[model samples]
Target: MSLLIVGATGTLGRQIARRALDEGHQVRCLVRSSKRAAFLKEWGAQLVPGDLCDPASLPPALEGVTAIIDAATARPTDSLSIRQVDWQGKVALIQAAKAAGVERFIFLSILDAEKYPQVPLMEIKRCTELFLAESGLNYTILRPCGFMQGLIGQYAVPILDKQAVWVTQQSAPIAYMDTQDVAKFAVRALSVPETEKNSFPIVGTKAWTAEEIIRLCERLSGQEAKVTRLPMNLLRTARRVARFFQWGWNLADRLAFAEVLATDKPLNASMETVYPVFGLNPEETTTLEAYLQDYFSRILKKLKELDYQATKTKNQKKKTSLRF
Candidate 1:
């Protein structure tokens, strides 16, 4: 089978490519850069140069492809709106795939896309999911829980800081998944008959709270880091301040953070279901101790460079103020 993976350079997309290749499928990556495609090339994937918003660039890649995994994310470089990428681009891809005689459409959706209306990201994903279901194409929807990578990617600030303090409402337990698991599951869904046109949820081994994640970091780092829950009013105020400083975070994202913190939406997916369907057994994930170790190890390396630069500046600041 020939599979075209959009967003092939991304974390999840890369993992999907690896798994697909291991399963003896010819994998073609749709990447925006030849440089980014190099790694995929090294991993034995053929690069199909393309972008989501540019339909003219995509048709060449879609030719002779059997399936498509629409993993394209909206980035700052995108001239199109989120609607254009998530909805309009998705619709276009479906039409192109149909024209190319593609068999399956694998969509990456979020949990409760409708319930989380405050965040435009979630809303966009939900909108795309709707388009896929109605497109008359065979589709498999994988609604993953929060990604563990988000800890490093989106929420890197708190994870890097000495004290991991987030302005969340309260520590709400969530079922997060490693991107590796998501990739494996994606491969299974693409190859296995049972998962076609089915909606499956992939999550962590166990549900963990934000506070627990902080504790895990502390344990991992072997450092005493506090998890302080900020007041909702203060969080809202801080978000406003953040926005004033040209931070592009939406108000809805802030509210969603609040909702997760305040409420207990114990997500309803189990490893039991995932193991049998995908032949995957959950691993003993890092508790607070292990996470902090890896987190701080990387953080300290960056901090050391900053400290060295600061010291160099101070050493050069010998001239005294001449004001009498």
Candidate 2:
């Protein structure tokens, strides 16, 4: 059966496409630009040029696809808000998919979306989940926690650069799963018949606090990392200031998320119940330590390259000065 992967150029979407292709499935990718998604073509994906924001662009993308895995996300710079993309765009896609006779629709949602309705992103995800459930189409909602790849860029890089990793007043532990693992589950959902009309909360085996993660980075990099704990009130104040200035992006949403992260709330539901349903072992997921070690090694290699370039430039300048 053929599968259409929305957001095929994104990190998680690419992983899903790769996994599906490896399993010998015919894969079609919905991308805004065929040129940006050219690499997907090399991976044997049929590229369909379309934008999620544009309802008119979706029917052609969904045509003749047996199933769909929607990993598309709204960017901060997009003309539409998260509500528009997650609700309106997704609804449009669902309507088109049903019209195209697509059987299965797998949606990638944020974990605890219902619990954190105050957060705009999660609120929109919850709304989309409801819409998908009532769409009269076969659907599977996979709510995955934050990705380790994102954490590496957000927390690990700052720690590696000898900069402080910031946290709110009450930092909570989060179950950050690898996107590849999430993709694996998504692909399995597409192939597995029993997963239809079900929702699964995907998470890693362990929950990691910001402090614990920072220390792990330090241990892996052999460098001491600093931590900065900001008061909740301060973050709220900063968010207000940003809103007053009409910042380019939504700082309020970001600050709201930061506050959510500060609480000791569980980011995801128990994986124990969902894993067996998917025929997965919780222990199979990547651990924080393993992810950090690999990430720190890459960071070290990059730092060495930068240092070499700087030294070479300095030596060249020294030689030129001596000649003068």
Candidate 3:
């Protein structure tokens, strides 16, 4: 059976494609350009060039595909709004997929999307979920929590680099799941009979707060890390100023994300119920510490390589100057 992975160029989408390919499944990618998705082609993924925003471009991408994993998302910097890509685009894809006689349609949504309708991103996701449910195709919705990659990049990396981790407010504990783990669950959902027509909240085993994360960073990196908290009023003012200027990107999205973090709420669901459906164990999920370690290790390796290159370049310049 062939699978079509929408948003095949995204971080999560790419991971899903790689996982499906490794499992010996025939994978196809619906990409805007085959040039940008050359890596997917190298991984043996059939590339179908199309755009989610353009409905006319979808049918060709959905052709001959048995299932579709909808992971496409709108860029905050793009002229496209959340309504366009998250809702309209997805609805268009669902319609196209249904007409194409696709059997299963899998959607990647945000965790607690319905509960936080005030947030534009969540509202868009909620609407898309509804549209997919009524699309008459066998559907599975996977709502994953905040990714470990996101937290590591936003919070942990700064600490490792001896910079402060900034926050709008003290956040509650969040169970940040690894994108790889979520990808594994998504691929399993396509084949698992019990997962059909159901929505699963996928998350990691442990929950962590901003303070705990900072402390962990100090422990792991052996460096004193500072935490800077910004007031909600200040954030709101900044958002307003950004909106007035018609900024390069969507500042409202950033503010909404910050609001979600500031409000003390649990972003994770019980993993006990989720792991069994995919025949996965809690221990198998990547933890915050594990993610931090791997992330910093890579950063250090890259810095070392840069240093070596700089030193080699200096030696070459010195030799040339001496000859002159």
Q: Please name the candidate that would achieve the greatest TM-score relative to the true structure.
A: 3
TM-score of each: 0.78, 0.89, 0.90
lDDT of each: 0.72, 0.84, 0.84
lDDT of 3 by residue, 1-324 (tens): 799999889979999999999998899999888888999999999998888899999998877899999888987776766667877888889999999999998899988888877788888898889888887999999998778877776776787677878976758678888889989999999889899999999877777887888888778776788788888888877777776655423656657766677678878788777788888777878888888888777877888899999999999999999999
Off by over 4 Å in 1: 75-80, 153-164, 226-262, 283-324
Q: Where is the poorest 10-residue window by lDDT in model 2?
A: 245-254
Question: Residue 178's C-alpha lDDT in candidate 2?
Answer: 88
Each candidate's clash count: 9, 0, 0
Which lDDT tens digits does candidate 1 get at residues 45-136?
Answer: 99988777777787899989999886676654444556667767777888888778889989888776777666667777888887788878
Better of 2 and 3 by lDDT: 3
Error of model 1, residue 102, in angstroms: 0.7
Is candidate 1 or 3 superior in TM-score?
Answer: 3
- TM-score of candidate 3 on Cα atoms, chains taken together: 0.90
Task: Report the lDDT tens digits of candidate 2 across residue range 1-324.
Answer: 889999888879999999999989999999888888999999999998887789999888777889999999876565555666767788899889888989999999988888877777788889888988998999999988788888877687787787888777686788888888998899999767779999988888788887787778778888887778889889878777766644423546656677678668867567777877788777778887888788888879998999999999999999999999
Please say which candidate is ahead in lDDT: 1 or 3: 3
